[model samples]
Target: MPCRWLLAPGKALRTRFARPLRCDVNNSRRMLSFLSSMSPDNAELRAEVARTRLSVAVGCITEVRGADAIVNCANEHLVGTQLPYINLDGAAGCVFHCVDGVVHKRAGPELHEACMSLAIEEGSYTETWGGIRCPSGQARVTPAFSLPHCAHIVHVVGPPWPSDAEELRDAYSAGIKAALAVEGPEARPAIRSLAVPAISSGIYQWPRDMSWAAAVQSLGGHLLEASLRRGGAGELPCPQDGARSGLDHVIFSAWDAASGREVEECLRRWVDGTLTEDGLL
Candidate 1:
């Protein structure tokens, strides 16, 4: 299938940081074919995978609307730390360079309070970091107050750069798990769509390529596992399965056009089997 790209109008993301949001979608037969070839015996699984839409986009995650939940790359302390030394030229003097800071800033102080409450519930305090709320590779969920679009936000802490790749993968997986488990009000529907940023790809310094690849692999594996369980492959029945209905979309977001292009390329490779269980080809 030929690759196609769509760039959302700049005005949409201009509420705070004005910039164009570029999105790349691939509803390719190649991806379905790969899934079919991998699971010839499980037609249901292949169909389920085909129904789920995965995309890569370039945009400020705070401006992403319509997602049932968005994932935040949070630190262990859940505090939005300001790195005054690092300056993003186009950030409009927004000292919040990291995603964690950006999210906290946009979402208001309420988010900070919620995170602290969540930390207390989890009993994850530690002296090493002066009371860590969420340890590395862990995830927590909170209401997206002040940010009216999404119902919830999943805060995830990833391992530092050049660390255990498995741990990074776990952080992505944990975010998905936390998002799936969110139980919103009766008027609100189950989380059927999620927007995720490249965890540990920024100030933490994990290579963007490696971070996105791990994200894709983890989410793909999750959908596959969910399909298996839903198809009666003999795994424990997921209780939230009925509530969720199923995740219809998972968007991987990049902060800028260059990174967005990189994410799209990575996704394209995954669809064609160039990026696989072992690593990128």
Candidate 2:
């Protein structure tokens, strides 16, 4: 169903969706208790949303099922170019290189056409790197095309090596916000669940720990901002109808087991107060 924005006096702008995912204050407390008892892979976001759930897992982005959107760690060009390491083996040896190539390969040439449309028709091109579509620290949204079990793809450009931590954080924040801003039929949020990869840690060569830190910080900052807007002290806003569609899930889909573990650890630290907004090291 389509979503609409709810703006009330002295209230934060909330995304309202059709189906009701009820979470009363008591239910929210129970949910929080249940989350704390669960593993770090299923950590608490502290957002206190009626239906939002945070998760970290090791899996391929293409394999993630049921998410409304999946984030692509795209380069500035948005052409879904493979990493050099895989290119060395020749196209016959490897079909895809990084997350961008993998997602684009799975979604077919139509995805590329859509990106090109955004670049040319929509004028999303940037002057960076001798001119490219979708600059660093920003995000663009497109149809998922042939990707199974997904509705949209949020393409985000991460900062290259030697960039500041804020750039990396902005990359993530922009992706999440882009998903929230995407409007489907009748102006509803195009996506509620977003599957994100550990961007820039792969070909961009950012340190794993630092990369995860920036990601966690961005996640926390956005969610916390939402909670504060709702005037949440220890309770989540839970209305009978028109439940907020403000990100039901933000799944951290790691490319490997080790990266998944790192993401979970960083999330756990955030939940335990060991990590803060400026936690990037």
**Candidate 1, superposed: residue stretches over 4 Å from native:** 1-52, 82-96, 120-130, 185-189, 227-240, 243-246, 276-281
lDDT tens digits, residue span 1-281, model 1: 11112222232321111223223233244245335534546545434453456666678888887688889988777766532323444443344466787788889999878876664425655554346777888998888888767878899989865465566777887887777676656533467688889898776666677788787767755655555546632233354444344455688878989878766776665554565422332
- Candidate 2 pairs with clashing backbones: 3-188
How close to the true structure is residue 117 of candidate 1, measured as C-alpha lDDT?
69
| C-alpha RMSD values across all candidates | 11.4, 14.3
User: Tens-digit lDDT track for model 2 on 166-250?
Assistant: 5677799789878888876656666767888888866666666667777776765455545545554234444321124356567
Candidate 2 global CA lDDT score: 0.68
Query: Candidate 1 at residue 148, lDDT?
Result: 67
